[model samples]
Target: MAVQENLLLGAKASKNATLTLVFLSILKGVVGFYSGSASLIADAIHTSLDIFTSLAVWIGLKLSMRGSEEKFPYGYYKADNLVSLFVSIIILFSGVELVREALLNIASPVEIKLQGIALGTAVFSVIAMYALSQYKFKVGKQIDSQALIADALHSYTDVFSSLIVAITIIGSLLGVLWLDSAGVLVISLMIFKLGIGMAKDSILTLMDAWLDKDSIERIRQNVGSIQGVKTVDEIRLRKSGLVVFGEIEIEIEGDASLKRVEMLFEEIEKTVKNEVKNLEHLVVNVKPEKISVMKIAVPVLMQEGLHSKVSRHFSKAPYFIFIELENNDIISWDVSENPAAGLEKKKGLKAAEFLKDQGVNVLIAGEIGEAPFHTLRDNFVKLLQMPEEIEDVEQVVKKVSELNTLTAPTE
Candidate 1:
């Protein structure tokens, strides 16, 4: 929408330039005919061409502004390029005619009348062309309108060409007859170059060429800066007249949820729109990448015989396990897979006293009831309950240790 608005603004500016040039061309033509000055006549003709080219630009802009249709799905954006190409050809032909006339004048020089009037008109035309060219150039850059830029170039060249003619006319009045024809030749060459440049640019646009490398790189940097985007896989840009359409493919972490990916997409769109002035359309696709998860061992304190019970049901037991001593002191206690029942009561009391003294923070066991759970909780010992039916003490112990690590307090 912003792109469309800018295009409209350019169209309006072009229309105004056309109207002004047409009025100036009529005035110049009347004066040139009365003065019989070839240079003024040539200037009038160039202004007339500008008026015609401006009309072409206005038509092209109007057509390009139309919405997409069934017959032409991409809309009429290329029409502007086509008009610019046609204008370039016309300008080129005008240059060729001017050159031909210049050659003839060089061969058979004629004294032109009203040198003062011709010089004055050329000076006024230069001032007008300069003002109009500056206006078009400024707006063309702002809106990214190639047609407007081409029109501005035409106006700029006219300013130089008219100034050259003015100098030639002044020289002719000073009896330097050859300068007039030489000036025309120089102006012809400049106009030819402008025509060729405009034509080449229009052809490039019609061919759907990509934008500049720097522009693509800037877009890549902007999209990559978005959070959750791991990398940019591919980017494509298509130019239609002044507007640009972009397609971007990005890679993101596989573990990143759908909501996160959506946020990244939104961010990318906003970033592109804000950064690139002529960006008309954008499509974003996200590709996910898989990552490995690492596992680590964690220590946890449990009631004495609790590990034994868990070991009896499950295969694994905690490593570097600690228990309370009989005197309520904490101590590292190791128990084999199968322990004798004779030491059960002593071990349980010792484990409790040791945990109490060491300030063992949490306990994990299988199926502890509310009464015992509350007792552990009141003692400031966090208890985690596991399912009683699951045997395999090794697996249970590993799972309990993993959970404790994840929820453990940091020092």
Candidate 2:
């Protein structure tokens, strides 16, 4: 339901319960006064307190419906839980009072008349409270309103207490005077139990407990299914009122462009929103996976490690072929004599085939003819043009790292 409609429904329900309880409280109070029944008076007090409880429920629902602000970016969804917590405390206090009164009555029995008026009032209350409880329970469940549910449960307890009151008064008139206090004591204990349960639920919500495992798994599966996503690194979700808030981190290919990554993020958002319902806020963090190093081969004249110069004459015999393994920086380097160096016949073809067999990812060179270039191209080797004058292996490696090219012009 829309926010405004939900708020209106909550207001209507609260108003109905408040008015109904008010009328019943007055009726019970008058009947209790005339009949002089202690149990009726106690029940009247309980009904009267429910008026305030229903009011709390309405206020909580209204507050919870408010939109997020600068100070409260997550909105007021926890207001309902806070109110429920307070209502539980109130119910607990009421139970303590009932227990004290029951003990006192049991210790010093007060002779009081149990008239037909008291019995009629108890029966009337039982029927009225039960009907109201059922209505509130249905509405509360429909809206997923915790405050409303708490109030409904509180009212339902009244139904039981009313029945107990009737039974106790009847038993007292039948000469078992202790039954009156005993029944009140039992009702008080039940109220305490209900209050403890409601408080536990409210506290769990207020603490931002994670949603069920199944719901989190569903979210993970949906987001992880998007194209270009390498993995779902992490996902966390918590319920706030009827809405869910989540944070997700995903890994994607390291080579994905900025635009491609952005598009993947958008897809993740759409996929999750479509699959998961009632998500209020979602924060997505994208991390690119690390790229592995490329092994580059440079045909060169080398006397030492750093003093290597590119061989000016391509396809000619070179003193050394430097294979530079690189990631962010050159992690290591290895030198091997060109096996096809100064070959008598088909020198370029032999050299190209030799480099291809070396499993070279890329070949940096000065110049080479069409035949050898085609052979390297067919072999899926990447070619990068480097200055013949460049003598530093580090400089060639840097150029190889910075440049993304294949089939450089023969210079």
Candidate 3:
């Protein structure tokens, strides 16, 4: 739906710019011939090139939107780059032609009978071209169309050339005849530089250059924040007309089940697409990391060091002691108050979340409930059950150390 709207608005903007250029071209030609303003006639010729450029932009918008997955898998988006190249060539030729005419006029200075009609026409062209440029620029930004933006810039050059014509008319009346030709020379050089820049950008886009730095960085930050993502491995993006296509690679723990992996993939995709406004599609690749250390969380009734007795219930515990493990040995342990303790309802789910946020890889709970069991499993936190008979923290840790003694939760 959004793509359709962009195409519609883009077509309208480019089409309107083309029609305006045609009107300005005719208006300048008739006025310049009768008034004997050589610079105005040269500007008229430049306006003609603008007509071609605007027309090409309109055509490009139409062709670029003809993307089909079955027919042309990569789409016809490259047509926009082709159109941009064509616009660049037209600008270069027009500038060269105008520059040559300016030099000839300077060599053999011509007398101008500057009439009010000629001056009025030049000023009017300035107003019209400026308005057209603004319109095209706004629409181009909204639709994210590079070709339309280039057309807007072409219209801006028209504004500069028209202003030059007005200045030339004033100079002719002031008897500074050389100023008219000099103004045309300045206008030509300005447009020539613009054409070179546009051509360079078009060539680079054709070569599949990476997206700009700011956009890539924003995507990276957003994707790296997903809960299960251990690392953001790669992000590759390219623009096709107004849309962006991308591939992203991320890392998570090795123990994540298939369902958990799928969930992480979905979240990563959502984050990336939301960060970039023009993203069309993304492929997420998930890799697993070989974890060396894991944490075990046990709900304790007292805050006593190591000897804290186990709580009677999962969420009703007063504190949680996280045991850090490397291989089968205990490396260290620390305890923190359970934020969800003493809750009348939904305690199991909230307590499960608290443990997950603490990076608990394995949980030691003798009286685990059903709701919290599923929650921990979904977060890839392993469940281990020790005998409720041995209640001391040190004794529970010793029992869980022998992997075979601990019973895991099951469906």
Candidate 4:
């Protein structure tokens, strides 16, 4: 669901960028043709390429939005990176062509008519480019969208190129033919540099490089803040257009219960999802520490007499006697509770059998019926029988801990 949301946001942004580029390209082309300015014409071509790149981005975003399948379990996220690479190649080729044309015009310059139509068109193009650049910039930040960022760069370059053409047109009206071609050459170089940068970014994303150090640190801090988590072992991040994929490893106590670990992971995942807008994937692994021994308290259920008997027999071992009174009241022998008012067993010997199967070492009670006694003895449970009149449950616990004998006769 999160991935779908991010993809939808990216797609909407891409569509807006595409429409802006198309409109700007048409406006620039009309202005350049009427003015007969070579630089203006070159800017129009660059704007056209922006339109094409935006379309590519839209298609890539759509493809990358697909959910994972058995054949492609990781989804189509790499599609966006590949499309960026394609866009870079297109930009590079267009830049080379523009440079070639500019060099030719430089060698043999053409006179351009600096008419009102041309000047007015350049003004309109400049305004549109600036507006689109700002929009793209704002949307890119909101979505953390790489495609929109690229579109913003394209618009920014268009603004600079349009301004240069405006200057060249003004210079040409004053009879400076060289200025027009020179501006085109400069624009070509800027476009070429942008192309190279986009190519490098695409390749790096395809190679699955980690995200920035600052982002990794931030994720580590957030994950470490979760309760029960001891430390963050590692964080792996990858990008596909606007989406971010993260895999985290956290260290927790070896003896921590599974429920605690799951809760910690859930908290971290939720924090990252809420904090990072474009987070599409998160995987968490908990590594436990090695330990030689683990001490855990095990609960046992038995009647009052059987509890006392086990407590007396295993007096030297650590144990607690739980007595079920007749009224469904759970009175612990470890507490000062009367044996006569012991709680009734809601589930009978079945419950004790279940506890025995769970590896409980001792059972303390006042008395047990024949059926339960035979069951406990068969399961090798050390039953300690308590006095019927004894009211202090705490004393029963101390007595059992001090006496170290077994209720079951020695084989």
> What residue runs in model 2 are displaced by over 4 Å at the alpha carbon?
110-114, 225-230, 252-277, 289-411
The sequence of per-residue lDDT tens digits that candidate 1 reaches over residues 1-411 is 475787688889889999989877887788767866566667778889998888888888888888889998778887788888988998998898888878887876667677777788889988999999999899988877788889999999989988987898888888888787788788889999999999998888788877477877888898888767788889888778777778899888645566887788788988887766677778887776632321111122333432433422111223213343332322334433212123534433333334445555555554333443444455556555454464433445445534432132111
**lDDT per residue, candidate 3, 198-246, as tens digits?**
8887788777776487878887888787777778888888877777788
Lowest-scoring 10 consecutive residues by lDDT in candidate 3?
A: 402-411
Give Cα distance to truth, residue 259, candidate 2, Å: 7.0
Ranking by lDDT: 3, 2, 1, 4
Q: Kindly give the number of clashing pairs for every candidate.
A: 14, 0, 0, 38
Residues 1-411 of candidate 4: C-alpha lDDT, one tens digit per residue: 465666677677678877877877787677777767888889889988888887877787788778889998878877777877888898888889889989988988777874567777777888888988887777667766666677678778888888888888888888898999999999989888988998888788888885477777787888787767788998888886677788888888645566887788779888777656677778888887532221111233333433433332221212334443322233432322222223354233554555465454466554445555567677656665554444455444445544443354321
The lDDT per prediction is 0.70, 0.78, 0.82, 0.69
Higher lDDT: candidate 3 or 4? 3
Model 1, runs deviating above 4 Å:
290-411
RMSD of each: 13.4, 10.0, 11.2, 11.7
The number of the candidate with the highest lDDT is 3
lDDT of 2 at 335: 76
Task: Give the Å shift of residue 24 in candidate 4.
Answer: 3.3
Candidate 2 lDDT over 1-411, as tens digits, reads 765566568768988999999999999888877776667777888888899999998888788778889999989877877888988998998888888878888876654474677788899999999999999998887766778889999999999999998997787678777777787788898899999999998898888876367767887888777777888989877767656678899888655576887788778777776755556678888886743666677777765665676675557847545555645577777777776776887778888888878777577776777777888887667787766556676777766656546454463
Full-model lDDT, candidate 1:
0.70
